[model samples]
Structures are given as structure tokens and as C-alpha cells.
Target: MTQERISLFVDHIGPFDAQKIGVLRGKANSGLELLNGHNIEVVQGFACEFDRLERFGFSPGAKIGSDFGDLDMALVQITRSKVETKLLVAQAWDATRVGGRIVVDGQKTDGIESIYKALRKLGIEPDTLVKSHGRIFWFERDETRPFADWLEPKLKMPDGFATAPGVFSAEKLDKGSLALIAALPPLAGHGADIGAGWGFLSRAALGHEKVTKLDLIEAEIAALDAARVNIIDERANFEWADVTKTSGRFYDFIIANPPFHTERTANTDLGVAFLTTAARNLKPKGQFYCVANRHLPYEVVLNELFRNVAEIGGTSAFKVFQAAQPRRL
Candidate 1:
């Protein structure tokens, strides 16, 4: 659905004649080919989408602090979070030169209507195109820079743990992860925390006295940046990666609070992929620990991958699993 909306917007806008274009929060299949003849710079934070764009021959990079400024045009893809959507649009405005075009696209479900109204409230009416249950709006940057205040909005940290808008469990510690942390046993040797959002589980895991080294693997760069601030130990290593597709190292044990959603929809396949990665990367006698919503059918894959699987602990709404003796494929 999002891909179709992006394609429609790109087609409606036609080819770009700008010298340089900036894309913020763009997905791998964001119909970027429509602007192929133009010099384009893409800012995508998610590792999976970033890798996909790279594999498809796009030079996608992370949007570090205030980069990609003075572009001829900027494209903004709105995310599910209203705050994040605003931030992306603010970034688009910041990157584009005065009088340059700033185009924004988003699904209705992602609060595009509210954002459109907000722009009107700021006294700048955009050229709007509504299609495919979504809207694509464009406006020329002006000297007023009405959205400049949103460019670097301050974020509050819950429980003093650094987090950003749009990251999972950003406002508070996740109950499922807390349950898994309580279930974890005394640790030793090297281990990994897959999908280690904001380093909550990794911080707890590092408390184990016998643990020698720990790796924090996450797909989202914003979350990883938060984790870096949250976990400042020599034993901890951070990697921005999609664990399911690329886990180059094996571990003595693996812990995860795997994500099961892509946007607003639940995707059990994502959890299954995390389980598969855990099994494939674990040492011969390694253990895998994870927590998930009680209704997700992860046990089937856990049983298939490991010789022993048991429910260690969890609340009624969540389940914590401990699997050992991974079967080598």
C-alpha cells in the first residue's frame, strides 16, 4: 500500500529537473527511479531498508546531524509517529534551499490529514494530491521557515534511558523485555542482544558478573544511537544491522525481544526470522532467550530449531522462552 502511494506520488510529480534532491525517511521501493536522471541523496535509517536500497544500486546514507542542506528539492516520507512525521517534514524544509520545492507523502492512516491541516495552521497552503488512501503535498520553501522550530525538538527520556520518537517502547521500558530480563540466568562468555532497542535488555544482561562480552544488534539507527548513550561499557559492542539477513558472527548465547510489526500490521514472519537467525548464529551448545506476545506462534519455530525449549517466565500477556541445543543445519 505504501509502495503504491509512493509510486503514484512520484508519477504525478513527473521527472525531477533539480540539480540535487534530498529524500528523508524514504523506503527501498519509494519509486526513486522516477528521478533517476537527477543527483539524489537518500537518508534511510532502518538497516533492512538501507541495505535493500544499497543492493538496488542507490547510495543511501544515514541522516547525521543537520546534513544534506541546500538541496534543490526534498522529498519527505511520513512515518507512523506524528512527532517523527513532523520531524521529517522539518528536515525536508531544512535541507531544501529557499524557494526550492518540499514534497511530502503519507498514508491517511499515518496522520497525513492532520499534518496537512497543521501546515495550513502555519499559514502555508500546499499543493495537494489525494490518492490511494493517501496524500502527496508540495510547497516551496519560503524565507519565513515556519517549521524551523520542529527541526530539533527535544525528547524526554523515560527512566533516564535515552530514546527517540518512532522507536519501539520509546516512552517507557517494555514489559515483555523486563519479563525476559527477569527470566535470564547467570551469563558467561560472549552473547548478543538482537533487536536491542534502547539497550534495556543489554544493560540488564551486562549485570551478570560472568558475562565477558555482549553485542547489541539493532536495525534502526535512532534506536542504536540511544542504546549507545544508554550502555557505555567496554564489554558492549554495537552494530547497525538486520539480524535476519546478516549476522556474521556466532555467539555463546543470544537474547532477543524481536519485533513482530511492520508499520501498523502484525507480521509473525518477522519474529520467525529472528528465531531462525538466533538458531543459526548460536554456538553448538548455545542457549537462546526471547520474549514475545503470548499469542504469537513462535514455539513451532523454536521447537524446530532447538532440541530443548521451555517457557521460563512471563506475565499473562507475554511469554518468555528459553531454547538450548540448537540443531546444526
Candidate 2:
């Protein structure tokens, strides 16, 4: 008789990459605590969350961006939404070697049961354990599951920009961004798009004949990858970086649609950091333009960092601010 192959405990995990194990977009590092002292590689694409993990001393054996590459086994903590979870699961399936395992965990509200059912449809069955308002499951490597389709590569957005799953405004051009673009004053010389997702704003910034070069700075690797394909202009530059830590440079102008939230919680600090960094990275006489939700408390920080701040244009749901003359602090 064949033996059943499922275990409820983390210790039950089968042989895996001795040299390296991967944690995919791990926010809390829940299951990882049990693997302490083992070689753990963390793959996270969001810059702000990565910064927090670094500050907390998660101390991964190695750090990587979006691509998990090849690994013996991967533990993926499910993201809050279905699309995000599907993307991560697809990545894990692609990254793990044959005979390797993919372990997944998430709260009930995060749709763990649905994900489990989906995996079953791929011709692979998962061993599941439900506890602590969440569920944990594991599945061995199987060749039959065609996960490539789950990747949804090079999806075209409504604005004709190339974007992918898990990136901001992936479905269409952001309406606030369009309004901000319309309100943009004449820009010149080298400029940048802070939090540039898939180069939508960067592409628009180039419309100004005086703007010779534009940099698209984004933290997410997937978005940057799409941006590479969308913005083919010789003058467009790309950088995958955390905006908060980048400074000591100067640009003629900077534009942003700074992210206002991390996870489910609203964080105005994220927007404020973008403003501060915008000030720090701009020439004394340079200009900053950004859009945000109408209620976000970013004006105080913008006023503190710039000699002049004004509401240039906005909708009832969003507000666009322009700041100039970075104040040396």
C-alpha cells in the first residue's frame, strides 16, 4: 500500500536546498523563525518593505529581487490579494528544482483554501494544515503543472504601456497621473520620476522638448523590467532603488506618484519620505511635482523641505502638489 504524504509541522519539511532556501515577499517571516541559522535567501520587490526588513535585522543569507531563480525549495507567505498570490505561486513553481517543494501559508481571509484548490487543478495535491486563523500547505515538484501561464508576461495596459501583475496601476494609466501630466509646467534638462511604475510618467516627462534626460526610479523589479521595454528612448534611465535612502544627487526636476500605503495600513510616512528624498535629490532651484490621495498629510513635509509649495491641480479624490527651491537643511 502507498503511504500518505502530508505533514502538519514545519519540521516535517523534506530535503531542500542545503545551500539556500528562498522566502518570497515575506513580510512577517512567520515560518522562517524555525529555519534560523540555516541559509535563507529572501526575495522581496517592494523597496519600503525591504527597508523595514533590513532595519529589523532579518539578516537573510542572501537577498534578491523579484526573480527567485532556481532553488531546492521555496516558502511563500501568501499575499493579501488573489492576483498577487497567484503571481508568487507561479514564481515559486518556476524557481524550484524538480523534486523540490513549495510551501505556502496564509490566513483564511487571504484565500489560502482557494489557492490550495487551484494547485490541485494543476495536477499537484498539497498537504495542508489549518491553524491560528490561517492555513499551511506544501506540495512536491511536479512536471505536469503548467505554471507559465500564471506569469502573465508583458501584459499591455490601457495606456499602451507594458506592465505586469503585482505592480502599481497595472491595469491602466493612473487618472491622477494623467491630470498631473497635464498640469506639469515646462521642465528642462535631466529629470527623474520617483516611484516610477512601468515608466508611464517618465515617458510623458520626455514630451517637454527641453527635458534632455529622464530617470525612472522604482523599487519593484517586475515594474522596472516592464519599464525597460516600454520606455525605449535613449534619454530614459532606469534604476531599482529605495527612494528614501537615495540622496546627494541633483536633478532639474522630479515627478512622483508616491505610494501611500504599505500592506493594508495607510502610511503617510511613505509619501513623506518620497517628498524628502525628492528635495534631497533635486538642485536648489529644481522643481518637484507629485500626486497623492487628497487626505494624505504630505504638505507639511513638502513645505518643510522646499522654499515654495503650491497646489497646482487635482481632482476631488487626488491632489497634485508642486514644490521648488529645495531648502538646504
Stretches off by above 4 angstroms in model 2 are: 1-8, 11-20, 26-33, 36-39, 48-71, 108-111, 121-124, 146-148, 153-156
- Model 1 spans with C-alpha error above 4 angstroms: 1-16, 65-67
lDDT of 1 at 306: 96
Q: Candidate 2 residues 104-157, lDDT tens each?
A: 877777687888888788777788777776778887776665777777645557
User: In candidate 1, where is summed lDDT lowest over 10 consecutive residues?
Assistant: 1-10
Give the top-scoring candidate (lDDT): 1
User: Model 2 residue 167 lDDT?
Assistant: 81
Question: Candidate 1: lDDT over CA atoms?
Answer: 0.88
Candidate 1 per-residue lDDT, tens place, 146-249, comes to 88767776676778999988899988778999999989889889999999878999999999988899999999999999999999899999999888975556
